[model samples]
Target: MSKKTVFKTASLTFLLTLIFSGIAFGQNWQTDFQKSLQTAKAEDKPIILVFSGSDWCAPCMKLENEIWSSDEFKNYSAGHFVLYKADFPRKKKNQPDTEQVKANKELAEKYNQKGFFPLVVVLDENGKVLGETGYKKLSPDEYIKHLETFVN
Candidate 1:
């Protein structure tokens, strides 16, 4: 190919790659539970509420890397679930605002009474609990299937 033709082809390829990769990894995890509830109601989607100790919990980190951050989960979850993360980070810098902390605690009281680090609770739009789970040794596809069981 000519130099100009090659440059055009490379630029087009790079742009397409950027676009598709953004779609693949665009998992919008809402930090505010109330906002996520509103989105769930409006979208008619189930809520995936995750309780995690991001800084101090090993299992939580594993779950984050293995499932939540996976392309399959991100892409699928975007269209199907309203994601809410109730993080209890131990690091000083990672700590959220007091109000957020309080909200997370309240959510824990109702859904994660036992204080599991990597608890996953699926709920309906109106905030009814569908099911609860924890970190499992499974692939992204398998994990998605497991979460779907709660909604179905």
Candidate 2:
């Protein structure tokens, strides 16, 4: 093989690896709030706790589809925040572990007593509440801009 062809193949392999790894990493959301808090403090990043009803809530599904799953949000969040999900799914297959369910319920008592379906709570590294938001009819960039106001 020629030098240029070998170099091109290597570069293509590296790019494909990065793209696939990014996609896998972007879907990672912590189930443990304490672990997320520790990571947030260590990384000097904020915590974004999403209280979602993944199986039943339309708004939660919309939030996931429209904002959280977007590449823009994933990229920004990967650098800037410790992501956590306290999902309260109605379906049995979608239910989390028992300990996770207990922890999520405890969190709900403190942050979401009224039980909002798609509540998003932003907190500082020390777990101080920075802001709360939910299901806005904005695109990913617009939603990120709105979050930036609270986080910054």
Candidate 3:
């Protein structure tokens, strides 16, 4: 192949890879609460319900980028809690399957998701309300502290 041809091919491959990887990574964000509860029961962990606007809300984006997506937060979160995310975007845009969107809507109703962005609800394996909080800005250390209170 010519040098220009090789460059174009490599660029296209990289872009496709990125698109697919983003889809996979983003899919992990929406999980069933019942399944999360099952996992929490098996693991003896609490459930951390993250209510977010993955596409548009400012603080929701910030908490993900600044805290939840960080190594520090993920590392701590991985073992302590069965994490579930309920997304109520200004527009339903997560491209979730119909069942998932329906379930999430139920969870949103049960959780009383009042059109707010970045609502955090912590629950036990039995769905007992441990507590609730909202995050506008939190550093990794700050987030860990807040999470620790609920989990421990």
Candidate that scores best on lDDT: 1
Give per-residue CA lDDT, model 2, range 63-126, as digits (tens): 9999999988888888888899899999999888899999999999988999998999999988
List per-candidate RMSD values in Å: 2.8, 2.7, 6.7
Which ten-residue region of model 1 has the weakest summed lDDT?
19-28
lDDT of 3 by residue, 112-146 (tens): 54756688888898888888887747688788788
Q: In model 2, what lDDT does residue 128 have?
A: 90
User: Worst 10-residue stretch by lDDT in candidate 3?
Assistant: 21-30
Clashing pairs in 2: none
Residue 92, model 1: lDDT of: 93
Cand. 2 Cα-lDDT: 0.90
Global lDDT of each candidate = 0.94, 0.90, 0.77
Predicted structure 2, TM vs. truth: 0.87
What TM-score quantifies how close candidate 1 is to the native fold? Answer: 0.86
Greater TM-score among 2 and 3 belongs to: 2
TM-scores for every predicted model: 0.86, 0.87, 0.75
